[model samples]
Target: MFECFLEIAFEAEVLTEEHPELQELARQLVHEDPATRPAAIQELRDMIYERGECAPRRMDDAFLLRFLRARRFVVPRAHKQLVRYCRFLEQYPELYRDVDLWGLARVGCAYEGCMLDRPGVGRVTILRFGTWNPDDYPVEELVKVGMAMMEIGLRSPKMQVLGGTVIVDMAGITMKHVATLTPTIAYQIVCLMGLAIPCVMHSCHIVNYNWLLNTFFFLFKRFIPKKAWKMIHFHGHDLESLHQLVDPECLPPRYGGTCRHHATIGTWFNKIRKYRDESFDRDMKEFGWVIKE
Candidate 1:
């Protein structure tokens, strides 16, 4: 199969503070009254057990809470969402088919990076929009790989429970790249992050963006939900200012942080690529079609 290289630092001391709401949700999922529990929750559980399908190691009350909270604990809607999540895995292998893919799809980690996790802010993510090389990868591949990155992040323990922050570096972007930000991609990204993936995006920082893209970005904002719209922040080119939000210690050298090795983006790419094929092969065996029986 494929591979995965990133090693999550599970140091208990590094974990900052607990997310009270999520802790309470975990409490409710286990201790709350069965009758008061939404019917859809039980139905989804029944369906999973009935199929005898094996869930991944991390699929616990925390995972169930994502769906429940997404639909606000409603029975029917939650049921539909649960079904959609499974079916999406079954059919949309190109996109939703990730559990089946080894390293979250064959997508490269060009535009995404994760490894920086802080306590209160959760998982610190980097979107190197400056690394966009359309010649190397097309739009379709971008969407699929991008979704894979999101899935990987959600699977992370801290991100799944405490939520996370995203840093979108806009340093090198121009009108040439704006074409890739199609309406379909924008809408799908919003829906994917908000619905399919359950991590709470606590904040999104836009650093080094040239003011010229404001009109385009403003138009792009219309397609996303108000919840996501509120999370986005523009920091322009000031890395020092950005450091106030994300500590310099958490960032790469280019951004004035450290990756324990080289601070350049190339090192970052090299780091994530190590797990590439291994993750793919193992995922297919673990979550693919035969397991459905």
Candidate 2:
């Protein structure tokens, strides 16, 4: 592994603060005697039910486990995060109101959005921003596509527990692309992603990015919650380096990696578009939420 690490050459490691103590907390949540586990879960549930005054969709033991895992299985932390997630959707319905899955897929195709075939540990995503013209599709739309992708990811049991990585390709970024990022929308996007989403973001790698990308961080870094900062990595313009961290087999040909079939942004887009069109009405509803009257 050390030799392999040197070959592609970048120092991107998963440095999340899933601390030892937190791991023990999570272990107890999952491995406690089956008899005792129910009560602990109930306690977590009551915190949500009594305080949040909302009942989110699919809050089963399995579902709650995802939250517990994300919050390091600390009941209060998980409860607070869960409440924020539900309330964000309810309060900002417009953001999700007319959820355009087809548009999302289209933009995603241009944005190079696709879940990788990483079978062992968790779901990993590679999002190529430079794949298409940002002028053709606004960055705001691209951000929404990301949100839609997260929603799509969580629908799977594996991703909910194991979480995922997001690779943002920056080769195509130009002044046109950067122009779309307003402070307000930028604030909204990160907060929505960093806080409101229930899925655990194992890590994110920013590749092929140029100097312009740093301006984004400089402008809005404060807006992002601190915990997420650790998950981000910078791998400037080097596919060889990225390939070190992510298997080349998992990447699309455009990225100087081996993945060919259904790998490009457009390929995944068409697949989703076709499926969504085939079942258009059924699948594109506003996201499910939990709120009390």
On lDDT, the candidate that comes out on top is 2
Query: Candidate 1, residues 1-293: lDDT per residue as tens digits?
Result: 11222333322212333455545643333233335555545665665667544342334554565565445465455455555565445445656443333332334434544455554455566666557677665655655655555554444434554466777777677776776777766655554555445555567788877765684476468766676667777777787877787777667677777643212233332443444344433543454311121
Candidate 1 stretches with Cα past 4 Å from truth are 1-63, 68-93, 96-109, 112-114, 258-293
Candidate 2, which segments miss by more than 4 Å at Cα? 1-40, 53-63, 113-121, 132-135, 260-293
Worst 10 residues of 1 by lDDT: 1-10
Give me candidate 1's TM-score against the actual structure: 0.63
Candidates in order, TM-scores: namely 0.63, 0.72
How many backbone overlaps does candidate 2 show?
A: 2
Q: What lDDT is reached at residue 212 by model 2?
A: 88
- Scored by Cα lDDT, where does model 1 land? 0.54
